[model samples]
Each structure stands twice: as C-alpha cells, then as structure tokens.
Target: MRRLLWLTAAALLAAGCSAAPGGEAAADKQPAPRPLGGVLHHTAAEAAALHRAEEREVRECMASRGFEYSAVPVGDGVRRRAAGNPYGLLTRAVAAQDGYGLTVERLQRHPADPNAQRVSALAEGDRRGWEAALKGTRDGPREEIELPDGPTVSVPTDACATVARRALYGASWDRDRYTVHSLADTIVRETLGHTLVRAAEREWAACMRDEGYRYEHRKDPLEELEKRLDTAGSDPAALRTNGREELRIAVRDAACQVEAGLAEQVSRAQEQVEKALPPARTSRLEEFRAAREGALRRAGARAASTT
Candidate 1:
C-alpha cells in the first residue's frame, strides 16, 4: 500500500510542470536558482536542538550545492511520528527523507569482515554511499521560484509537498469511489450465485420427475410425501447441506469478484498517480506497476480457481 501510494505521489508531482500561477511572475524577475541537496540527521536531541539541526542541515547542504534552501515540513504527521518512536523510527525516516526514491547501489570493493563491529561499520558505510550516489544523480529538473532569501532553491516541482497533498486530499475520494464499486460487484456476484442455486434445484426436480414420481400437481402433503418416498428417502439434512454449500459457493465467487475489482482499481489509481511524476521516474514506476499487476493477476486467478 505504501509503495502504491508513493507511485501515485511521484505521478502527481511529475504532471506537466505548468508554471505555478505566481511562479512565472517571480521567474521573469529573477535568475534561475541552483539545485539543492539535503541530509537527514537522526541523532538523539531535544526538540529545540533537533529543529535547529534539521534547519541547519537544509541550509548547509543547499549552500554546498550552490543553492539557497529552506526547510519545510512535508506534512504535520512527521512531528507526530517523531514523537511516537523517536529512536526506532528515525532510521527509516532519515533514509527516505530526500524522497526521490531508494538510493541505487554501486557496489564497492570492500574487504570481507568477520568481526561484528566491523560488519556493522561496513553496512553503515554502504548505506551512506548509496545515499550520496542518489544525491549525485539527476532525479529531475532544478525548478526555480521566489523565496524569502531572494532566488532560492525552490522545492522541486516534483517534491513531496504535492505527493503528501494528493494522498491527503484525494485518497478518501479514491477510497469512497472504490468502495461503491466493490459493493456493486459483490452484489452482482452474490445474485449470480443465487441464480446458480435456483438452477440446481430445478435440475434436481427434473431428475426426480424422470424417476417417475407422479403427483407433481398434488396439493396434499400426504400425497406429495407418498410420491417422494416412493422415489427416495426424504432427508431434510440433504436440503440443508445443499443450502450451506450454495452459500459457501456464493461466498467464494463473491470474494474472487472483490479481489479482481480491488486489483483493477489499484492499477488504475496507480496509473493516475504516475502521470504526475517526472518522465524518467514515471518510466521506472510504470515498470514496477506492470510487474505488480502480473503478480496480482496470477495470485487472484489461482485463488479464484482453487476449491
């Protein structure tokens, strides 16, 4: 789900970079700003200290990259997350803080280590190396805009700001629409299963008729019972079991329909989000979606056919 959300976010950000209504006016009067760099520091600190450090790093990294940068919280949830799991969560939070995507690895030739401390160091070094490599590569264009400090490195057009916005503003809408669709699909599948049960009962009646049980039009219970007994044992459990089986069959069929409907909705939602991403990032996300769809389809089909 997180991956799907991220894919959608990338698409939203990458949508045709129409000039922000006020951005053009600012752009015409200013020089194109330099690109910015960012770093995530996850050391223990007081709230005041942490805030200062974050702001400082944003400033320093931007300066190093020849652009002026300012720190902006991507969402209000960040502080809450930080408050909840200060130590344990920082690792992942810092890892994706830059937010273009996972840092790609260019494996280095490092000596193998058997010592635990040495192995830990090696792992840390690898993680840092990958982050540096990602920061060095071209994630997208350097978008410029007005800032308090003259022409600063405006947040990239394809930034987490829009990604977070899309999830917040549009996710509920998407879910609501998908829910309506799922309910409608579930009902249709359930109705079809009921039809199957009715058909099976009709077939059973025809079979009984073939066995020469007369009194098909008999209104008397005694007459109907006499004819039924002449054909076969009148076990009430048989009909009850048949009804239970019918219900189970209905549930199975309904579940399959629901699964397929969900997968299709997710796929379309993912595509819509992808349209917002930068072309290169968009292409990468598309490849991921295709692979995901293939896996989901196989799983859904297998589950539907089983039992």
Candidate 2:
C-alpha cells in the first residue's frame, strides 16, 4: 500500500487592521497598521478596542475586495477564561485561491505576538491531544504493518502511515496558521524563507572565504550519500547503512548551525517588525518556516533510509 501525502496551503487574508473597542469613536481609535499586516496591541483594553476596529475594517476590506462578513460573539462563560476577551467574528469572501467559492471562518485572536516557543508549544499540545484521542479509540488488538521497500519511497497506504501523515500535515498547517497573520503575510513569509536561507548561506560562504576557512557547503548530504550508494550498487545495503548514519550526523551538525543562525535572525526580524507593529499580533512567520524546512529535511532523510 502506497500512502499519498498531499498538503494544500491555506489561503489567508488579513482580516484587516482592527480596533479594540470603543463606542462612537471606535473607528477613530483604530491602531496604526503594522508593516507585517494587522495591528497588535498589548493590554486587553487596547486589544479589545483594536479588535472592534479590525472587525469593522476586515468587513470593509472584504467588501472592497468583494466579500461578506459577520460577527459571532463568544458567550460569557468562555469569554471570561480568555483574558481581555474580545468578541470574535467570521468573514466569508471569494478569493482567487478559493476558486471564487464562499469561504467563512472566525478569525483567531492569538494570545500574543507570534513567537517560535509559543508556536512550537501550541503544536506539541495539539499533537498530544490528537494522539490521546487516537489511543482512546484503539482498544483492539495490535498488528504489525509493513512499509514499502526502497531508498526513497512514498508513504504507505497502511492505517499507521495514514495516521502519521495526517498528524504530520495537521501539525504543519497548525504551525502555518499560528504564524500567519494574513494571507499576504503567509505568502511573504514563505517566499522570504526560501530567499533568505539561500542569501544567508551565501553570506556564510563569503564569511568563510574572508576567514580563509576551507569548509565545503554541501547542499544535501542525503543526495551525496545516494550517489555513492549508486556507485557501490553491488553492496547497496552496506553503503546505504553507512550513508544513513553519516547523513544523520551531518544533519545534527547542520541543524545546530541552522538553529543558531535562526535564533539571531528571528530576534532581528522580530525587533524590526515590532518597531512597525503593535505588541499583540506581530508575526514570527519566518522563524516558523525556517524550523519547518529543517524538520522536512530531516524527515526526508529518515524516510529515504526507512523505505
């Protein structure tokens, strides 16, 4: 059984800059638009006010873009648990990405600005909850499932693989949504990661050259190992085993360097974004993407060997 793993990026739109809450002058109190997209405010009072303004702006923005919107109030019971809880609303719009179909969902009011630690924590909690529910449902006998045989093969159609893929993509989208402030912001974050990673690597190479360090930057260790295995096809198993271990070590080293680089970049980027954004919703989209790419690379290497 071959597993088909498909992921579709969600089409997001900045609901628009919102105001927390105010009566007649609410429109005048709207927070300044941040460079990243929506406005972020610190205090619940501010967030509430901005939230209201955003609700109105988002509706207008959608209408200008030819979409409809409505408001949904969270009951008092649930609102109390949420600090400075502001009423949430849903927006429905026809966008090119949705094939011009009706799209409706309540925009989330995240607790704080997008931070890597917060994003990862949220993803882990979600994954744990999902696993717990799955465990509760599986009270029957256990059976061993077989995986496909190959150097790099597709996911299996087995139940286990299906579950794994769902889990993986769920986490992927969860992280994506967490970092994404708006649809435009998501696109920019994704594009920036691809461009920045290459640019940063190039910069690192330049730094090495200036320092006279004879370091070679291999694009993908797994590919390099695969090539060596092809040459030693008669002893493929041995070559593959060796290659897998070496790849793991290489990945660990690469991951460490990437982590350090990401830390610095995230800090710098966050600072820059915050300067232009309010305290509530500035995003850590770029950092999230960097981490996602690193995980995908590691997962790919593991899949190649396991298959």
Candidate 3:
C-alpha cells in the first residue's frame, strides 16, 4: 500500500512555495527540524549506491554462471519492492521536478527489469537454468525464509541475490532482512498515526481542500488518479494528459505537506514511536540499521572502485 498511509507518502515529501498557514512568527521560521535514525533510513544517494552495488553483484554472478543480466536503474518497479525504503522526504526540487515520481516512472521506455527482454529471448531450458542459478533450487535445503507478514521468500543461500547481500551487508544479511523487511510499513504507519502526525494530517487535509483538491486523506488524490488513469488505457495522448494531471495534483500535495508541517511531524513522531517499541524488536532494529550502514559503505566503495 502507498507507504502504508503516510498518506500521499504511501507514495513522499515536501517543499511548497506557496504562502504557509502561519503568520509572521511562523513565516520567520523554516520548516520544523526533522529527527534522524530509524529502522528504515537511507538517503537517496546511499540508496542509489546500494542499488548499483547489488545489481552489479547479481549481474556479475549471473555472468559467471553463463547467463545475461542487465541491472535496471531505480524506477517504480523498485519503489514498492519488498525490503526497500525509498519513501524520501519531500523537498522543493523534488516536488517541482518529479512530483511523486510516478509520472517519470510511467513514461519510462523499459519495464521494471531491463533483463526481462533478455530472459524472454532465451530458449526455454536456458531460461530455466538462468532462473535456477539466479534463484536456486526451490525444493532443496536452501529455500526462502518465512516471515510474519507473507509466505516464504527466497533469498536462496545459493543464489546471486543472497550472495550480493552477503557481500554488501555481511553474514547477518539474512537476519537484517528478517528484522526490517516486513516492518518497514508497520513502522511508517505507527509514526504517521502518532498524535502529532494525526494533527498535522488534519491541517494538511484542510490545506488541500483550500487548494481545490478535496482530499480528506493524503492518499485520496493518488487513489483518484489511479482510477482515472485506468480509463486512459494506452492511448499516447491520453497518457500524457494524465501524466500532466498527476504532476499538478502532486505539486499541490507537496505544497500542502509543507504548509501542514507533515514531513517534520512524521519524522519526529517516528523517532518517538521507535523509542517506545519493545526491547527485543528494538535490538533487532538496531542490528538492521547497522547492517544498512555497513552495506552503504561497502556499496560506496564498490562504486568508487568501478569508477
């Protein structure tokens, strides 16, 4: 679900240029300072580096096994992927350039995976070998890990993906995945639903209505946009029109987020909510965070080496 009710954030962030709601005292101040540190924390730069490193690992591994793989750039396909947290804080540059980033995603020429073309082009047996090598034998001792929220997920010990994680996140990669994968949204929801954030939502909703978008909840416009997009189908002109409309709605949403201090509210609430979690979960979160930072460092090094 859209980042699990971070409202439009189920999608992100804000830097609104319009006049803010508060008077001179508020106007004199900048946006509220946000807190740092969470179970889910990765700046866009770190994320991009990690993405590149992981893709390189998988690609190189598959090549060693006599298969072709092309690392896809970060896109919508990756955004909602399990175990990823791209729910970036909104900024003015972000809103003006990308809105919620979906329009750019929608307009892309490639699918979620560039390698889909290669896989489709392969002979059946070759394709099976490729899949097996990348994912490993599903029935053997090395199967996917089971989690609280979903069915068993494969991070097959024998697979390229698992190898990539190991290289980037060290031996605790599996444990790290287990800790953070299912809880990303859970954490996001708790933070967003905190009292402070709830109040901020009310103000944001009011601001949206004032802007002529009657969205009681932040995700409303996105939901509406999706439904409207369904009617557009594949007509180029229709898609372009919808894209433009999406940008319009998103720009306003970003502005409203700023006027309401939603981003700051969520960040602060997240810090508080995380502090209140049970000790066991808290420990696991700490472990996950350590792994993430380690991975970022490794990924950055790899990126530099390649350059």
Model 2 agreement with the true structure over 218-301: per-residue lDDT tens digits: 234335544554565545355434433432333232333343343234334434444554433434455545444444554444
Which clashing pairs does model 3 show?
2-10, 3-10, 13-90, 14-90
Question: Tens digits of per-residue lDDT for model 1 on 138-159?
Answer: 4654344332222344333233
Clashes of each: 8, 18, 4
Runs in model 2 lying further than 4 Å from the true structure: 1-199, 206-222, 229-262, 270-307
State how far residue 124 of model 3 sits from its true place (Å): 3.3
lDDT of 1: 0.31
Q: Whose lDDT is greatest here?
A: 3
lDDT of 3 at 136: 74
Highest TM-score model number? 3
Q: Which regions of candidate 3 deviate over 4 angstroms?
A: 1-39, 63-89, 111-123, 143-154
Task: Rank all candidate structures by their lDDT, best first, as comma-separated numbers.
Answer: 3, 2, 1
User: How well does each candidate superpose onto the true structure, as a TM-score?
Assistant: 0.15, 0.23, 0.75
Model 1 residue 289 CA deviation (Å) reads 40
Score residue 54 of candidate 2 by CA lDDT. 35
Candidate 2 structure lDDT:
0.33
